[model samples]
Target chain A: MLEKNKNLLDIKKLKVSFFTEEGEIRAVNNVNFSIPNGKIMAVVGESGCGKSVTAYSILRLIQKPGKIMDGEIIFHPADDKPLDILKLGEKSDELYKIRGGKISMIFQEPMTALSPVHTIGNQICEAILIHQDVTKIEARKNAADMLAKVGIPNAKNRLDHYPFEMSGGMRQRVVIAMAMVCHPQLLIADEPTTALDVTIQAQILKLMKDLQKDLNMSILLITHNLGVVAQVADEVAVMYLGRIVERSDVRTIMKNPRHPYTIGLLKSLPSLSMEKTELPSIKGSVPSLTDIPNGCPFHPRCPYYKPKVCDAGNPPDLNAVDDNHDVACFRTSQIQNEIAGKERCRL
Target chain B: MNENIKNITSTPLLQVKGLCKYFPVFSKGFFKKQIGVVKASDNINFNLVTGETLGLVGESGSGKTTTGRAILRAITPTAGEVILNYKNELIDLTKISHKKLKQLRPFMQMIFQDPFSSLNPRMTVQDIIAEPLVIHKMAKGSVLEDRVIQIMKKVGLKPEHKSRYPHAFSGGQRQRIGIARALIMNPALIVCDEAVSALDVSVQAQVINLLSDLQQEFGLTYIFIAHDLSVVKHICDRVAVMYAGKIVELAKTNEIFENPLHPYTKALLSAIPSPDPDKPMNMNISGEVADPGNLPPGCAFAPRCEFCVQQCEQQIPKLKHLADDRYVACHRSWNVEDSP
Candidate 1:
């Protein structure tokens, strides 16, 4: 996968599946990516693209019949040792240390993420106590310090407030506080600002950026919103169906999107610069997981689909378009040529 | 010929004046008594031009949806005057009876946010579209079926899929079904409350294009309620920005986005993460939305406002008219208009 010594978290040939009444649902297929230390790698896709599933598999958090069929998540700790996250037994000492201790995750819905009954302080303190060998008072002091650091007004007074007593933005900050109580090296924020208001979302995003800078932590930001990805992510991994279609540095992905799905998504967005007469929409809805097409899954809706190459068989493995950029499409070079020629894409 | 005649007319379609919807908050104790009122919508006013879209934009709990519901009488408003122009007569929609309102319902319809929950899971697509016609006694049997098919085709649904339920369809298709139901009655006024918020980007675009096309074909007036400012800017001719149960600002689509006067509006505009990475976030509004039950004595946004003054805390600002048909509610609105 990644040159082992350099990557903080390297995922190679990851596959996740969900067992249902009908059959097995292949959710994430052969996905590979690497997160460097102190950088944010955003995994973006529409609903059911398996971005969340891939994140869940990193911590062995897939619930019920859904399981990580095959994968290797190589996490390089600070001391130059690589730990296979997948091999760690569930609820084992090492697994527990890495799950919330070294790598903490924040969810989309802040209100439901935090327990309603417990005070915000108590919840944060619990996380601190679990990982640290500090007394309750010291943990409480650290928790309040984190609350203030996340920009909570009257941080000391807020220590006694329950989850219901706080606003959505406040709850999200509390969740962030909980995640950072132990100062984790990696933070997996799954649409952390989706539930808050746009204004409040601004505050939360800023808060996360500040925290990442201060703590020097790597982040796996999984979201469907491309705008959010562009704003915060250093690099991006675009997923469609169950596979990662493209991965690149954020700037290149935004300016020179090689994938058809990425192009459609960008064109569909309403820009603040000009009023669009019509937003160019990709034809048809996302195909049901059970009824996904063979070969390139997007061929049915792809404007540039070739009969023999795109639809005849499986569309081949991910190929490198540049040193830093990789695209899974069979026509990566052709698309790149077209984009270089300033050819208009069928959005 | 009919379209030409409609174009020649200058009359506004809907007029909302002093609209207010307050939910009573009871004190928690053995003896529960009304302690305060959650002013969901307070003294909101706007006029929708015929064959135009008026976008209602705000944060959650800002009463953007309440304004739409009040006009439709989906929720009975505490106080308001909602005048709807139908045929040659203007009727007070707020004062009408359930019987009279039923008759008027055909011309005014609403599409909800969630496509999944809004549509009945048990009903087939055919029956769902035909329900409106049946309730109004407009069509029956073959005619109803024909009408449903015609509307469905317009919204991009096939005749073969009519037998299937909403559950069988995708989110985008379900939204289309919702749109078809709203348009079946040939509504003059359609209130789309967060219609595309639940759909994916590509699907959202498709639905938006469909809505625009339908608007042009039917000469429909829309009150598009959404928190997304970009979508509002695209579809709406004018916009009313709500905050703390009050319409803090109203202006033309371009004017609202380009030259926002209200502090809250400015903050919201800046908050939208630009897809272009070069453009960084410029505004930071401290704290959350103020409690609607107990809004500040001054401007509700005063607590978080950067330019808030003593007047802001002592007295509430009025939605005062400004130049260029713009309206703003702020003590320091003059400063905004003059700023670079």
Candidate 2:
């Protein structure tokens, strides 16, 4: 059922854990998914759900005490046969060949990503020089060209501007320029616009969407905000406590969410439409990564909890209801029935 | 419109007029010379009746938080009249003494954004909640302990967890503790400064519900200062949009959302990323927020605004009332279209 042959990047049983002094923090459990070529896949969850950890693991960016225990990251290049990224050495040329050169990443804050002292032009050129075979003058020209492509005005003049000299939106554009200068196939954006105002966030999102189309690159967007997910994502992976509870197209996930956690997340958002008066909050908070609940991690706080069924059994396998939609829930059929009834009533 | 103006000013719970707070920036040398002033809260005006929520909406450096702090007397205002309707008397807080302000503090309280840093890590949850009461000399000894537990229970915090430090609790729980402390004093007015902004979606809902519940039970008024328009639209009865240390728009939540007058408000309303995936994301305001220290000769938002004309660049718009309780500060307020 797992179509590795047709996918761009297929991850199977990817487990990432951090060993704290107190105990082992199982940040990511056996996670599985595939990013289709040129598709925007969003893995969304609250803090400590291991969404960021999963993103970081793709490039082996896991810091000290954190280990990617076991997983087969089958990456299918445009010309070559599928190869497992997990098998590559830490400092291997193969790993270096893919990281930044093929799959680049952008962070939430642009200031931290770019050095304050370095000029914007120098920073972009430096990245281009390392990845591409180019002369000093050619790299500078390419950097200015990149700035213009990202919608920055007067690209040549902006080359000498420091990080602090530009606005937040401009700084983010520069960061995007730096990330996309190499023209990577897949861009992993982790809360890229979280720190920005909604206005600037719109511009940034627009930039990324435009760039994706122009470059034909897939995007893995990691965020806690469902609103952002709704805006840009083609497919959504709802993660809860280090596990994918649901994965489907953005429309299906928003319209017919079968997982209780996904339902609660949708319900939790205060509507701009002013449809709902009181937000039906999911009970209890996310458990500490070190002391996660047994069985389904979301069962304890889930509203439609079944005493022994949800709490006792191991997390259910991804049960397919539609063509591509999948939900990991023991009572998936029950939720489907309830949702159908609600829709009928509304109709 | 005149009728609304009369009712709003007749007996407001808290009335602020032309409130201004400017922080001096000094040019450093052996001798420090005053260079310029950071116009934090400039000529701000608003009024809130009892048991009503007034949301102060803005981005960073918009002076929403500064306005809240100045109202609470946390920071002294440069100039303005902050009149409070305490015990059927109009008391000017700006003119009150520090000693008098201390006594009147129990009537008003402010909850900060970051609960982790706001609550003392050294003190237990019980002590954190009890400190306000002890200082006011309202309850002491066993009575203080009982009151803290009572308030904690009201906010869904378990009495058993009272002895635990803030570090032991989660972000949501710490926020609950913060809420408990704010509600313990039974204050008439509470300024929730981005209260639920630091929380997760599911957890943010819990805190928002808790706040709504508390306001209902106690008939409390809140000056909800936040960057999230969705939250403000959900919880607030009325909202005030701030731009560069000034009140740009003020109206009922529905009015502001459905038919915003000011270009800034329209832009802000449109900027919100709707949770419904089908909703179009079109509003994209470029250009940085105008520096408060060295503002332009005209409207602060004129630079970024799409519909700004030559008049906007040369004239500073004054806050003026429009149709029935709606107020907007823009030279071309009538010309600006509403959010789609």
Best by DockQ: 1
- lDDT tens readout by residue for model 2, A185-246: 88999999999988788888988998999888899999998988999999999998899999
Clashes of each: 0, 0
TM-scores of all candidate predictions against the true structure: 0.97, 0.96
Q: What interface-residue Cα RMSD does candidate 2 give after superposition? A: 1.4
DockQ class, candidate 1: high
Per-model CA lDDT versus the true structure: 0.89, 0.90
Residue B91, model 1: lDDT of: 93
Instruction: List the candidate 2 regions with Cα displacement exceeding 4 Å.
Output: A1-6, A341-347, B1-9, B337-340
Candidate 1 per-residue C-alpha lDDT over B1-340 given as tens digits, one digit per residue, 9 for 90 to 100:
2254357446678889999999988989988898888999999888777887889999999998988999999999999899989986999988989999988999999999999999999999999988999988999989899999999999999988999999999999999999999999989999999999999988999999999989888888899999999998888888889999999999988989898889999999999999988888787688788889878899999999988889999999999998755899999998756766
Local accuracy of candidate 1 as per-residue lDDT tens digits, A1-347: 43446678999999999999968888998999999888999999999999999998888899989989998999997754688999998879999998789999999999889898899889999999899999999999999999999998889889999999888888899999999888888999998988889998888888898889988889999998888888999999999988999899999889888898888888998777867487788999999888778889988988788888887677558788898998888787786677666745544
